[model samples]
Structure formats: structure tokens, C-alpha cells
Target chain A: MQVATFLAYLVAAVLFITGIRRLRKPGTARSGNTIAAFGMVIALVATFLVVEVDAAWVWLLIGVGILLGGVLGAASAQMVPMTAMPQMVAAFNGVGGGCIALVALSEFYQGAAETWVAVISGLLTVVIGSVSFAGSIVAFTKLQELAFTGSVVFPLQQVLNALIFVGILLLSANVLADGAIVEAVGAPFLSPLVSLYILFAASLVLGVLFVIPIGGADMPIVISLLNAFTGLAAAASGFVLGNYALLIGGTLVGASGTILTRLMSGALGRPLGKIIFAGITATATQKGDQQEDREVHDASPGEVGEYLSEEANKIVIVPGYGLAVAQAQGPMHDLMETLESRGKEVLFGIHPVAGRMPGHMNVLLTEAGVPYDKLYDLEDINPEFDDTDAAIIVGANDVVNPAANDPEQDTPISGMPILEVEKAKRVIFVKRSLSPGFAGVDNPLFYDTEKTMMLFSDAKQGLQEVVEAVKSA
Target chain B: MEQLLVQLAIFIIAAFLGFELISRVPNLLHTPLMSATNAIHGIVLVGAIIVFATADDTFTIVVGFIAIVLGAMNVIGGFWVTNRMLGMFRPPVKRVRKRKG
Candidate 1:
């Protein structure tokens, strides 16, 4: 039975790897998700078979837990709109982190830390798991705009976090020292178990501190980083229990999540270290206030639509988080169709970090029944803007901000790769105000009257009006 | 010690295999890939069960039970949402299957 159980775990790990392998392509990604879920089922059944439950009440508890969790999980997964997928992922990831932390705490309760390996790994799990849990909850709230959507910072913020880290290390060291000398002394000043509880609490606080300073616009990288932390915590718990399935599955997520974090930060044109440490504080640079008073060309949606319908032959649409906030994807799709019917070439230029997460805009656009090929990636569409007649930007600012290219200006988004929309013959911005983006950097493109126009309105309403004007024209 | 050595070996190899598996996912599938891997790590459910079954005291039992519930939610919700997100990415042709043969 032991051998059979281990074999089942190995088979489940193989299936998980195969599923991720299949996830590399769009055609097979859905089946890949199904395959991974199947692996989870196998591992789950094998776990139930091997665990020796002597009490009938424990069985009832287990059954009820699974049933309740399944119903809630399935309900939310089905009901959550695609626009809210980032927060949904964060919520689920938080639960997983919390679950792992509890597992570590329970292991300590069972006195499984007799050996040195067990003591270290168990403590590691408690720290990382608790941090991941608390951090993920904070991330979810930020993305959901529940309490505080902007970055929170004060003087000596990083110093306070550093002091807390040192304190946790000192406490953990005492725990390890207590474990080492307990058999000899018979009683120690501080019980290792008590130290662990303190460590867990401190780690949770550290997690909140770690995420609260990161701005909401940087939530994608933060989410990916927290996801990786949870994976590592799970692997550490696997070490505590000597479980093969947990080790393999956790390591897979840990590695992939780390790589994904790097990729996301790279796409946003920021180094991973800078993003984690400095964060985008949105300090409201001096350029923002002065730009408001500058002369600008603001056009009505009808005039802009007439330009697209009559003057422009090839057009590109750039989308941002504002599009998601205004729920404008549907209306935007109507505008796309209208432009296409006019014998104009219309393609979507999707910056990798355009929305709240990587590929976020792509998912929203695809959900609105836009053809897959109609969307082009950043690298694929950057050069095409030069020959394009007009670029229609909907609620996107920083991603297309010309400041990223100006070597003279030292803005928060300086040196970040932008869409180069100013290269197009004409640029029209549909936005609520001349305000800067989440990064708090003013856009020179909005002020270029010779080729740029602003249609001031909500994203959905502006798109609707533009569609009507284009149709009538 | 030998068992620990074996587990460590498995961990390193799995880490390498993971990096290789998702090294080059296209931007189109990044969200689904993150969601899928998120579900895979929900394998912590197995660990939760192991702890719960062996727990003797009330504190341990309560902690273990909550862990089980959270793990189950993570597993179910992660995979279900990934599937839904991936379902939105259809090919260029619209409703091709609706035509009669």
C-alpha cells in the first residue's frame, strides 16, 4: 500500500508537468487546465486512502469540509466576471497560503520537529506561509479597491520592515536554540512552541507591510511574487511531512511563478528588484500640475469618429485598466466592428502590462467575441504604428506616454517602453481628464495639438458616441 | 538522512523541470498559465489531510479542518477559473460547428 501510494503521487506529478507543457499554446490551454485538475483529483484520492482516520467524526469533518469548499469555490469561479479575474486569483491564492500555514502549525502541534531538519523546515513553512497568506489578502484588497487602492508609505517604512525582519530572525534563532538544548535543560526560558506562535504573528505583519507599500498599478507583479512565495511555503511544508506530491507540485509553482514575475516586470520595463524595493510611489511630480494649464486640442467624439471614418485608412486601438473599470470592452468591440466595416484596417495593440495583469486586456477583448488574430502584441505592433494613419487610445496613459522616451526628463515611468503612439499620423485620447496615469507622470502626447486630440468622457460612453458617429458618417 | 537526501534531489529536479516547462509561454496565454500553476500548487491539500488525520488535540484538529477547507477551495476555484478564462480564447472562425453537415 505504501509503494502504491507513492506511485500514485508520482503519476500525479507527471500529469501536472504534462498539463503545463500543453498550456504553452492557446488551442490546448483549456484541456491543459482540465488535465492538471485531474492530477489534483488523483493525488486527493490517494491522500484520503493513505491517511489513517480512526474516528468516524473525523471522516464527517473531512467530507463536510470538501463539500463546503467545493460549492463555494465552484460558485465564485463561475460567477466572477473576467474583468475581476485578478482579484479572484488573489483570493484563491490567499486561501492556499493560509491553508499551508495551518498545516505547518498542526505539524508543530503533533511534535514532529524532533529532528533538526524538521525543526528548520517547519519553522520556514510557518514564516513563509503566514507571510504569503497575509500578503495575498492585502493584494486582493488593493486590486478590488476595497480600502486603499494607492500605495501607503511613511518615513522610515523600509527601516521598520527591516527591524521586523531582524526581530523575526532573532526569535527563530531562539526557537532553534531552544530545540537544541531542551533535552538537557529540561525547561527553557521560552518554549519553542511559543516562539513559533510569535514568529507566525510577526510574519503575518511583515507580509502586510511588504504589500501595502506597492501601488495598485503594480499589483500584477506583487500578485505573481506572492504566488511564488506561497509555492515555496508549500514546498517547505512538504519537507516537514516528507510528502512527494507536495514537494513536486509546490516546486513547480514556485519556479514558474518566479519566472512569470520576472517576465511581467520585464514587460512593464522595470527590473524586478526595483519594483519590489522602490515600488511605484506615484509621487506626483511637478510636470503633472503645469501640464494641466498647457494649451491642448480637445475634440468631441463625433469629430474624432468622423476622422476615423473618412480620413484614416489604417487604425490601432490601445486599451488600459480604465477600459476595464468603465466596462467598455463591449462598446469598444462595437467600435472595432464599425471601423472594420468601413474598409479600414483595425488592429488592437496590446501592451503586455496594459491592464491589471499580463494578457488582461487580451482576455477581456477575446471575451467580447473579437477574433484572436485581430489582437497584436507589443513587439509585433510597435513598428506598425509608424505607418498607421491614426491611433485611438481608450483610457490608456502611461503605456503610451511619450515621456518614457525623453532622456532629459526623469519621471517615474522614464525609460519604460511605451507604445510609441505619437508616431502615428494622428492620435486621439478618449479619457475623463488630462490627469496623469497611476504612475503619476504627465503625457506629452496629450498636449501635441498638431496630431493629438482628446475626447473627454467616460470610456464606455465615449466609445458608444464614437461608434454612433462613425456609423452615421 | 537518506530519505531527506532523496527528497532534496526530487525537489531540485522538479524545479528544473518546472522552469523548462513554462519558459516560453506566449503573452496570449499568460493569465491562463498563471491560473493553471496556481491550481497545481493547491496540492497542499494532501499535506493538510495528513496533518488532520494525525492530529490528536482539539487545537490541532480545528486547525487541520480549516486547512482542509481552504485547500479544497484553492484547488477547486483555481482550476475552475482557469478553465473559464481559457474558454474565452476561441479561434478566428465563429460558430463553425453550427452548420449542418
Candidate 2:
């Protein structure tokens, strides 16, 4: 039995490593997921071998958890638009934290109530889990556009939080010291309860403080950080449970989450500390105020198609959340193919946070089988926009907004990085309506007369029409 | 043997369901799901710590302590790495082009 448990844990660890590796590239991600899942199944089987429980009840619990999780997960996946993916991530993180806390609670109940170590572990689990759960929920709400995402500040907020944090640490220290003495005296309950209560309060406050200062722009990093936190908490719980597989699995998750968070922060060009404390709102006005120019080029779809066919020597396609919303990846791919066949130089410019989630645009494009080489990150592609004959901006708003350039805009997105679509000789925009982006500000780029045309339609439909127009032409 | 088979079946089914759910979700949800799973592992940590601190056997206690340290390291290290990764996306300061007189 011991050997079997070890083997199962080893297998699970291997699978996890492979899954993480596969996740780095688009082509093998699904296979990696399957492999990891298989390993988890092995780990679960191995866990049952060590921990004997009522067979009927364990089965029932597993069934119920699966059924509930499946139903909820499926419903959310189907109902959520691609734009709300960040929010969904937050909600999922919260759920994970809640589950960990619950598991810790159960473990505590099973242990000797007087055991200080168990009590400390339980306290840690509950505090971290609760904060992650609540904080993630807030993040989800913000990303979903269902709640106010701006920083909520009261005077001395930081000071108050600091005090609470210190208090909790002090309480933890006292409990640890007292627990050792109490165990010697055979009186463990008193110290542990006090520690648990203090830890819980401190964690809750910490969660709020952690999230309150983060604006919507930093959500991707926040989600990644929370993910790491949850992984660590899981590893901690694994220690408490004395489960080798859990420890390995949890450690892998925690490590990966941290790596992803760093990658996300790097993508935003912000330090982690600045992101956590900057508290800047994501107002759309960052693009300098919309210059009053009614001289916007009003090209019909047919006219735009003609211009695209005639003058575009090198065309760059910039996709946004609008593309995902319209499910237009297939049509976009077809359009790219048509352009390529016609000897037009075509490539895609991908903003890190272009779509609802980080790398969403890349994922959607990859699914459509766009060549990896054709996709370029912002830094590599920004300079090429100037020389390109035409730049097609699809379903993207704030990323292309000129307000990022205007110093006086005073908007939260001011000084933030953006794609220089305005520099392109000819600019074409595909959008459903003039609805503002996450920053809720109108784009002045839409009104630019310098060869800018708005192809107002659903992204998928718009791309499909363009494909047909190109074919006929 | 029958009980083991039953448990295995249950485990497989649960894992399959989890996989299916994960597949349908957008990329953004992946991190959150991972976070939630990590939290569940925290419970496992608490359990091990309790067993280690209270168990009469010296071997069990020693093993538990080692596991606890490793687990704590994993959590702390993971968060630190995540913080570093998120620093990647800060917008670069635009260089002012100096005009030659």
C-alpha cells in the first residue's frame, strides 16, 4: 500500500510537469491537460488507499462534488462571453480557496483538538482560504463589469490594514509559543482558538486591502497572484494532511501560478508592487480628449474592401474582444488566407490584454490555425504599423486609443502602453457599435479623417463579408 | 477488491468531469481554477501538521514536519514567482525624440 501510494504520487507529479510544459505552447495544451488529469486520477486512487473512510459516504461525496462542479462550470462556460473571462477566473479562484478551507476544517475535526500544530495549520488554511475566496470574488465582479473596479479608499486605510496585519502576526506568535507550553501542561484548546480567530480576522482584512488598491488593468496579475496563493495554501494543507501527492501537486500549482503572475506583470510593464498599490482607475479618457473632427472617413463596406484590395501592400490585422464576441476566428483566418494568396503581406498584432483575458486573442487565433510566426507581440509589431499600408483594427478599442499618447488626458489609462494604430497610413475599424471599452470612454481614433474607416458590423459577419468580397473581387 | 474498483471508478468519473469542465472554460478561468485547487491542498497541509504534532510515534512526527516545511516553501515561493511575472506588463516610458538643431 505504501509503495502504491508513492508510485501514484510520482505519476501525478510527472503528469503535472508535463501538463505545465505542454501548456506553454498552443499545439499541445489539450494533450497536456489530459495527461495531468490522468495523473490526478492516479493520485486520487492512491489517496483512498492511505485514508480509510466509509466507502459509501466517500463515493457519495465525490459524486456530489463532481456533479455540482460540472453543472456550475458548464453553465458558466456557456453563458459567459469571452470578454468576461477574467471575472470567471476570479470566481473560480474563490471557489478553490473555499474548498481548501473546507478540507482543512474537516481535517481539524478529525484530529486531536488539543494538537497545536493541527490548530495552526487549520488557522492558516482558513485565513488564507477565506481571503483568497473573498478577494477573488471581488476581482471577478470587477472583471465582469458587474461591480465598481476603482479603488475604494478611506483615509488611513493602509495604516489600519497594517495595524491589523501586525496584530494577527503577534497573535500567531503568541499562539505558537503558548501551544508549546500548553501541550506540556496538557491544555491546547485555549491558545489555538484565539489564534484561529485572530488569523481569520487578519486574513479577511488582508484580502480587502490586497484587492482594494488594484484597478481593472492589473486584474490579470491579481488573478495570477491569487492563483499562486491558492496553490501555496493547498501545499500547506497537504502538509497538514500528511499527503505526499497533495504536497507535490500543490507545490507545482503554486510554482506555476507564481511564474504566470510574473509573466503577466511583465506583459503590463509594471512592477508587482506598483500594480498592487497604484490604485489607479481604468477610465477611458486617457487617450487625449476626442478632438472635434466631424471629418471622419465614412467608407462603405464595399469601398473599404476595394481600398483593402488595391492599396494594401502590407496589412496588419489587430483583433480585439469584439472578434471573440462575434465568433469570427474562422472568417478572420479565411480573410488572412485570402490576403496571403493575393501576395499581400499580412500579420497579426496581439496585445497581451487585448481580449477578455490575457493571451485570449492569441488563443482564438491559434485555434483558427494561424501560423505562429505571423503573430507578433506589441513591442515587435508597434514600429511596423507606420510602414504598413493598412491596419485593420477589429473589436479593439482602448488598446488602440490615442489617449494613451496624450499627456493631459488625466485618465487612469494615460501613460499605459497601447498599440500605435493611429500611425498607420490607412486605418480600418470593425466594431458592432460605438460602445466604449472597459474604460467607458469614446475613442477619438474613430473620428480620425486620415484614411480611417469604420466597418460597423458584427466581427464574424464583417470578416465573412470581407472574405466574400475579396473572393468576388 | 470490489471496493477498490468502485473507488477507482468514482475517481475516474470525477476526474473526467473536471477535465470536461476545464476544456470548455476560456483561458482566463484556468488560473482561478488552479487557485481553487491549490486552496483545497491547503486543507491537506493542515491535516498533516495536526497528525505530526499530535502523533505518539516519532517517525510520523518527523515525516510530518518535513512535509510541512516543504509545503510552506511551495506556497511562499509560488506567490513570490507570481509577483515577479506580473511585473512584465508595465507600459514602457516613451522616449522623447530630440530634434537636431
Candidate 3:
């Protein structure tokens, strides 16, 4: 029986690794997810059969838990709109972190960790897991706009976080010392349980403090980092239980997440430490307000459509989170089709960090039935804009902002790579206002009257009107 | 102590494998890749089951039960959402071609 259980775990780990390997390409990604879920089914069933249960009610409780969780998770996953994916992913990650924390707590309550290694691992799991849990919940709220999406920094915020972190460390040490005392004397005088709960509470607070100061623009990196933390916490729990499947599976995700976090921050031209420690300050917001009075060129969607149909032969569309917010993907697709039908060549210049998450714009465009061949990456499309007829920016600002290239300006997005949309024959922006993007830096591209035209409207209505005008012209 | 050494070796090797596997992925599939990995870590449900099965006290049992539920949700939701996202990446239908021709 023991041999069979270990064999099953070995097989499950192989399947998971295979699935992740297959996920490298678009063609195999769906099958990869299915393969990984199949591995999970095997691991779950083996767990149910191998675990020795003494209470009949425990079986009933476990059954009910799986059923309820399955129904809720499936319904939400099936129904959530693609635009809300970041928050949905955050919520799911939060619950996973919560589960690891609870497992560590239950292990502590049952006195299941008999060795020093298990004790240390259990403590580490509780701290990391709770931090991930609370931090992910904060991330969910920020992405959902349920709370203030800007960086929230009180006076001495960093100092307060440091103090809470130190407190958690000291409380964890006290628990370890209490456990030692209990082992030596065989009697519990000062219980470790009290110190353990205190450690958990402090870690939760530390998690909240860690995430609250990060602005909405940096959510992708933050979520990736927390996902890594949860993975490490699960591995720690595996040490407590001597479970090979948990150890292998959790470490795989931890490594993958760490790499992704690095890649995301690198794409934004920000160091991971800078994003985490010195949050983008209030200076960027103040800078945007200083330019509020500057007059800029504005045009109607009809004029822009006329320009596209009459003058532009080649067009490039740049999309951002606002396009998703306005639910304009369908309309944007319609406009693309209209241009194509009129014998205009249209392509998409997709920035790496164009939307709320990595590859977010690609998924949204693809969902609107855009062909795979129409989308081009920043490196692939930047040179194309130089001789292009028009660069129509749909609800995007930062990626097209020229300030990123100016060495004299030291803004939050300085030195970041941006689309060279300004170099096109004509620039058109479909935006509601001259407001800054998530990084809070006002774009100078909107003010270039000779080369740019701004149509101030919601992205959906703006794109729909453009489509109608193009059809008529 | 011996078991600890073996587990540590496995952990190190798996971490390296993960890094190598994910490093090659292109920018287009990143969100789904993240979501898929998020689901893979849901194997924490195994640990939750062990805790729940052995609990002799009400507090431990209650905590274990919640852990199991949350872990199940994480596993189910992570994979399901990933599948949904990947399902959106279908090639533009043949109608666009027919219309153009």
C-alpha cells in the first residue's frame, strides 16, 4: 500500500511537469491545463484513499467541502468576464494562501510536528502563507477598484511595516522557545499556542502593509511575487508532512512565479526592489495636475474616420486597460474589419505591459476574434510606425507617451520603452480626457496639434462611431 | 534527518526544472501560464487532507475543513479560468478570408 501511494505521487508530479512544459506554446496550453488537472485528480484521490480516518463525520465534512468549493469555483470561472480576470486570479490565489495558513495552524494545534525541522517549517509556513493571503486580498480589491487604486502611504509607513515584521520574528522565536521548554519538562506552563496566534496576526498585518503602498500600475508584479510566496509556503507545509507531491508541485510554481515577477518588472523598466520598497510617490500625480490648463487638439470620431478612409493606407491600433474598461474590444474589432474591407492594412502594436497584466491585451484582442497574424510585439512593430499613415491609440497613454524618451525628465516611466506612434504621418487618440495613465504622468503626445487628433469619448462609442463613418466614406 | 536530505534534493532539482521550463515561454501566453501555475500549487489540498483525517480536536478539524475547501476552490478555479482564457485565442475564422477574397 505504501509503495502504491508513493508511485501514484511520482506519476502525478510527472504529469504536472509535463503540463507546464506543454504550456510554453499557444497550441498546447489548453491541453496542458487539462493534463495538469488530471494529475490533480490523481493526487486528490490517492490522498482520500490513503489517509486513515477514524471519524465517520470527517468523511462527510470532506465530501461537502469539495462539493461546495467545486460548484462555487466552476461557476465563477465560467461566468467572469475576461476584463475582470486580474481580480479573479487574485481572489483565487488569496484563497489558496488562506488554505496553506490554515493547514499550518491545524498542524500546530494537533502537535503534529514532532521534530525541530517540522516545527521550524510549520512556523515559516504560517507566516508566509498568511502574508500571501492578506496581500492577495488587497491586490484583489485594488484591481477591482473596491478600494483606492493609488499607492496608499501614511507617514512613517515603511517604519511601521518594519516594526511589525520584527514583531512577527520575535513572536515566532518565543513560540519555538516555548516548544523547547515543553519538550524538556513534559508539562506546558506558558503555552506556545498563544505566541503562535500572535505571530499569525502580526504576519497578516505585515502582508496588508506590504501591499497597500503599491500603486495599481504595479499590480502584475505584486501578484506574481505573492504567488511565489504562496508556493514557498506550500513547500514549507510539505516539509511538515513529508509529502513529496506537495514539495515538488509547490517548488515548481515558486520558481516559475519568481522568474515571471522578474520579467514583468524588467519589462516596465523598474527594479523589483524599487517597486516593493520605494513606491511611486505622489509627485507623478502632482505633475499631471500642473498641465491641466494646457490646450490640446480635439476632433470628432467622424473626422478621424474620414482621415482613415481617405488618406491612411496603413494603420496601427494601440490598446490599453481603458479599452478593456469601456468594453470596446468588439467595437474595436468592427473598426479593424471596416478598415480591412476598404483595402487598408491594419495591425496591432502590443506593448508588453499594455494592459493590467502581462499579455492582457493579446488575450482581449484575441477574444474579439482578431487574427493571430495581426498582432505585433513592441520590438516587432516599433519600426513599422515610422512610415505608417496613422497610429490610432484606443484608450492608451503611457505606452505612447514621448516623455519616456526624454532624458531630461525623471518621471516614474522614464527610460521605459514606448511605441513610436509620434513618428507616424498622423496620430489619433480616442480618449475621454487629457488625463494621465496609471503611472500618473501626463502624456505630451496629446498636445501635438499638427501631428495628433484627439477624439474625446468612451472607447466603445468612439470606435463604433468610427466604424459607421468609415463604412459611409 | 536522512529523509530531510532527500526531500531537499528533490526540491532543489524541481525548482531548477521549473525555471528552465518557464524561461522559454513567449510574451503572448504569460497570463495563462501564471494562472496554470497558480492551479498547480493547489496541491496543498493533499496536506489539508492529512491534517483533517488525523484531527482529534474540534479546533483542528474545523481549521482543516476550511483549508480543504479553500484548496479545492483554488485548484478548480485556477485551472478553469486558465482554460477559459486559452479558449479565447482561436484563430480568426475563415469568414474574414472569404469576405476579403
Candidate 4:
């Protein structure tokens, strides 16, 4: 039995590693997911075999849980739109954290409490799991558009949080000391119930306070950070349960989440702290500054196509959620291929938080078989916009909006990070209509005159037509 | 050995089915699922505490107490945090004012 359990654990660990590796590449993500699921199956089987539960009622409870959870999980995936995927990821992480925490609690209850080690492990699980659960829920709500995703600062919010955290530590010492005193004095220890409740409350409040200051624009970073928190909680729970497989899995998740957070922060040209605490939007506004009016350019789709074929030195494609909604990746890839064949320098400008999730644009582009190297994050490609002959904005709105820098816009999205597409010599926007973005703000870039063209149609169909036109040319 | 293998298989299969089913739900249902699970954890905590307070065996009693506390923390902490986070996602309502010339 032990040998089989070890073998299963080994297999599961290998699968997890492979799945994580495959997750880095967009083409293999689905396969990676399947592999991870398979690993989880092995782990679950091993766990059931090793854990002793004598009660028949326990088995019945487990059966009920499985049935209930299964139904709920299936319903979520089918109903959630791609636009709300980030929130979904956050919610899933919370579930994972909650599961591990429960497992730890079960283990603690089944073990001898005399061991200081077990008590410490239980405490660790409570702290980390509580934080992860609360933090992830906050992240999910923000991503779901159900609540404000921006920074909310009450005076001394950080200071108050720190004080509360200190209070939790003090309470923890009392609990631990009481346990020791009971053993030393041959008396019953005070119930840890009060301390547990207090600790849990403090951690929960801290999680919300920690995430509330993070703005919507930095959701990718927040999501990554919360993922790391979940991983840490899982690892702590694994320790409490003395589960090797759990430890390995949790460590991997924690490490990956941290690395992803750092990479995202770097991509946004900001530190992790700033990403977490900076309430500034992608575009920053200055006080007492008048909105500058610039000459605006407008052109028909055909004329823009002609300009691309005739005079553009280089072209950069900016894709957004609209591209995903319209299923335009295939057509866009074909258009890029045509442009490259014409000896045009074509690159893609990918914003960090473009679309609903981090790397969403990159995932779509990679699915279309666009070379990984050609995809440039905002910081990497911002400088190139100046020398580029034409910037093709496709289905993207807030990221490419010039109003991010326009001081007088008074829009909620003003002072947020946005691609400086206007800096490009010629700008062409492809859209079905002049609809506002998710934030419901009009983009002044639509009216930019230096060299602007509006190609009206669904992104997929428009790109297909452009591909054909370029092919014929 | 065969019985153990069978049990393991059953557990794995059930877990897989459960995960697959849960993953398919809509966004709105996630919180409700979490809330329900939290309630279960609370029940588990209460059961553990009762066992600990009444059990004759010292080791079992100690273990039960630990489990109870940890389970309680999970239940209370999870729900409290989720609610606070949900608060952040609420959209601001605009107030309309009458024009006074």
C-alpha cells in the first residue's frame, strides 16, 4: 500500500511539473490542463488510501461532497464568459486554498495535540489559508465587475492594518503560551477557540485591506500575487497534514505565481509595491491642465489599406478583447503573414493587462501560431512606435486611447497605462463602431488627425478582407 | 490489496468527476459554492470540538481539539474574507438631481 501510494505521488508530481511547463506556451495550455487534472486524480486517490476514516458516515459525507462540488464546478466553466476569466481564476484559487485548509484542519483533529509541531502547523494553516481565501475573493470580485477594482484608501489604512496584524501576533503568543502552561501545570488549557476566531478575523480583514488599494489596471499583478498567497497557504496546510505531494504541489504553485507576478510588474515598468498600492490609472492626469486639442485624421478602410500597401515603412498590430470577441486571430495572423511577405516590418504591441487576463492577447496570438519573439510587451515596444510608419489598432480600446495622457478628460481611466499609438506616423483603427470600452469612456484617439483611419466591420471579417487585398496587391 | 486499490480508484474517479463538474459552472455560482463549503467546514469544526470535549482517550481528545480550532478558522475566515472582497466589486450608483434654475 505504501509503495503504491509513493508511486502515485511520484506520477502526480511529474504530471504537475509537466503541466506547469506546458502552461508557459499558449499552444500547449489545454494539454497542460489535462495533464494537471490527471495528476490531481492520482494525488486524491493516494490521499484516500492513506488517510484513516473508520466511520461509515464519513464516507457518505465524502460522497455527498463529491456530488455537490462536481455539479457546481461544471456549471461555472460552462457559464463564465471569457471576459470574466481573471475573476474565475481568482475564485478557483480561493477554492483550492479553502480545500487545503480543510484538509489540514482534519489532520490536526486526528493527531495528538500534545505535539507543539502539530499546533504550530495548524496555526500556520489558519493564517495563510485565511489570507488566501479572503484575498482571492476580493480579486475575483474586482475582475467580475461586481465591485470597485480601484484603490480605496481611508486615512492610515496601512497603519491600521499593520497594528491589527501585530495584535494577531500578540494573541497567537497567548494561545501558544496557554497550551504550554496547561502541559506544565497539569491543568486544562484554555480553549483556543477565541484566539482562532480572532486570528481568522484579523487575517481576513488584512487580505481585503491589502488588495483594496490595488487598482483595476493592475489586476494581472494582483491576480498573480493572490495566486502566490494561495500556493503558500496550500504549502502550510501540507505541512500540517504531513503530505509530501501537497508540499511539492504547493511549492510549485507558490514559486510560479511569484515569478509571474514579478514578470508582470517588469512588463508594466513598475515595481510590485507600486503595482499593488499605486492608485494611478494607466494614464495620469495633471491638476489645472487644459485638455490639448490636436489635429485629427480620418480615413476610410480602403484608403488605409492603400496607405499600408503604398507608403508605410513599418506596421505594428495592437489587439484587444474585441479581437477575441470577434474571433479575429486567424484572419489577423493571415494579415500579418501578408505584410511580412511584402517585406514590411510587423510586430505586435501587447499590453500587460490587455483583455481580461494577463497575457490574454499573447495567448490568442500564440494560438494563431504567431512567433513568440514578435510579441512585444508595452515597455519593450513603446519606443518603437515613433519610428514605425503605421500602427494598426484592431479591436483594442482603452489600451490605445490617447485620453490616458489627456489631462482634462476627467475620465476614470485617465492616467492609466496605455499604448502610445498616436506617436506612430500613421494610425489606423479597425472597428465595427465607435463604442466605448469596458469603463464606458470615449477615446480621443478616434479623433486624432495626424494619420487616423477607421475601418468599419467586424474585426475578423475586416482582417480577412485586408488579407485578401494585400494578397492581390 | 485489491480492496485498497479499489477504494483508491473510487476516490480518484469521484474527485476527477467532481472537479470537472465544478469547473463548468458560471461565475455567479462560485461564491455560493464557497459559502456552502464554508458551512460544511463549520459543521466539521463543531463535530471535532464535541468529540474532543467528550472523548476518554487523551490523544484523541487533543487531536480533536486542534482539528476543531483549525476547522473553525477555515470556516469563519473564509466567509468573512469573501464578503469583504465582494464589497469591492459593487458598482457605484449615480444620483440624479433636479435642475433648479
Model 3 TM-score, 2 decimals: 0.95
DockQ of 2: 0.06
List model 2 lDDT by residue over B62-95, tens digit each. Answer: 4444434333322322222222222222221122
Question: What does the lDDT come to for candidate 2?
Answer: 0.62
What is the TM-score, restricted to chain A, for candidate 4?
A: 0.77
Candidate 2, residue A436: CA error in Å? 6.6
Q: Let me know the DockQ for model 4.
A: 0.03
- CA error at residue A416 for candidate 1, angstroms: 1.3
lDDT of each residue in B1-101, candidate 1, tens digit only: 99999989999998888777767777887878888888888998899889888888999989999998999899999999999998998877545634633
TM-score (2 decimals) of chain A in model 3: 0.95
Candidate 1's displacement at residue B90, Å, is 1.2
The collision pairs in model 3 are none
DockQ of each: 0.80, 0.06, 0.76, 0.03
* Model 2, span A117-208: residue lDDT tens: 54565567776776887788778877766775665666677677778778676666556576454455454545654555556667777886
10 residues in a row with least lDDT, candidate 2 chain A: A279-288
Residue A406, candidate 2: Cα error in Å is 6.9
Give me candidate 1's TM-score against the actual structure: 0.95
Which one wins by DockQ: 1 or 4? 1
Better of 2 and 4 by TM-score: 2
Predicted candidate 1 versus true structure: per-residue lDDT over A225-344, tens digit per residue: 888888888888888899999999999999888998887888888877876875334343455445547878989988998999999999999999889889999999999988988888
- What C-alpha lDDT do the candidate models reach, one value each? 0.87, 0.62, 0.87, 0.60
